[model samples]
Target: GAGVSQTPSNKVTEKGKYVELRCDPISGHTALYWYRQSLGQGPEFLIYFQGTGAADDSGLPNDRFFAVRPEGSVSTLKIQRTERGDSAVYLCASSSFGTGRVRNEQFFGPGTRLTVL
Candidate 1:
């Protein structure tokens, strides 16, 4: 199976708009995750999913940020009322085993760059 893939390599939007970023994890991967990276900073975890449910979403900054992995494969990160502070690279990752339980490394996508004005 292929590694994770994120659509729309780059996106630019005005403030207050809505945006959806997509991620397709490798086949058979049960664990999926989303992260945000700002310049000069490490990637920050946003949400994690096991199968069709979110196992952890504590890192999501606010209610305006959300993600879904309904089919346990393809996932989408939804952002509402976008702001300049939201500008960053959105990344998606996956592993064959669930987090905190597997010693295997997670595979990462190239990331989707989002810029808000």
Candidate 2:
């Protein structure tokens, strides 16, 4: 079975530019998550979607970051006014419920590395 996938594996842009990163989760996954990882640091949770609506966006630093999963399958992360500090690997993961009400393991994509110069 196929896992999660992200497009434009690497992106290079200048400060103030806008960028959009896309993610395709595994089929039948009802929970999707977005995270950002910087050098020498663990991934920081950004936003999460239980379905079409964002369940938690508290991790978003400010007004510059946003994400959406309209169809509950594919998601897109939008960044505005990119800054050098925004350079990092954007990761996407998805999970679902398993038997006995347990939570399934979250499968992660390779991620899109964005470099802002």
Candidate 3:
């Protein structure tokens, strides 16, 4: 894909249900990030992956939320026992941290809007 892509642009689920949001980063990017945005707020960092392993996961609210990037190209955000407060837009971004690259240049997906009813 030319840019980051996310699946099922919208998701509606009942409280306590499990939902998985998927992200496909641009090819060859070595870093990926997951963020959540609530109404009128900026995107909140959730997780950051460097290749196949997560480098930073401290931002995840609790054990109920998790993310994985097994092969390093694609990622998934899984929410267990979803709550009404979990209703927000989940965003995925990708960037390269190659040699001599001091900063990350992120390309973002359209995001998956999760509605916990």
**Top-lDDT candidate index:** 3
Best by TM-score: 3
TM-score of 2: 0.94
Model 3, position 21: C-alpha lDDT score:
98
Report the C-alpha lDDT of model 2 over 4-114, residue by residue, as the tens digit. Answer: 999879999999999999999989888989999999999999998998999899999999999989999999999999999999999999987656226457889999999
* lDDT tens digits, residue span 25-78, model 1: 989889899999999999999999999999899999999999998889999999
Q: What is the lDDT of candidate 2?
A: 0.92
Candidates 2 and 3 compared by lDDT, better number: 3
Model 3 lDDT tens row, 49-110: 99999999988999999999999889999999999999999999999878626766788999
Please give the lDDT score for candidate 1: 0.94
Worst 10 residues of 3 by lDDT: 97-106
Candidate 1 at 68: error in angstroms?
Answer: 0.7
Q: How many clashing residue pairs appear in each of the predictions shown?
A: 0, 0, 0
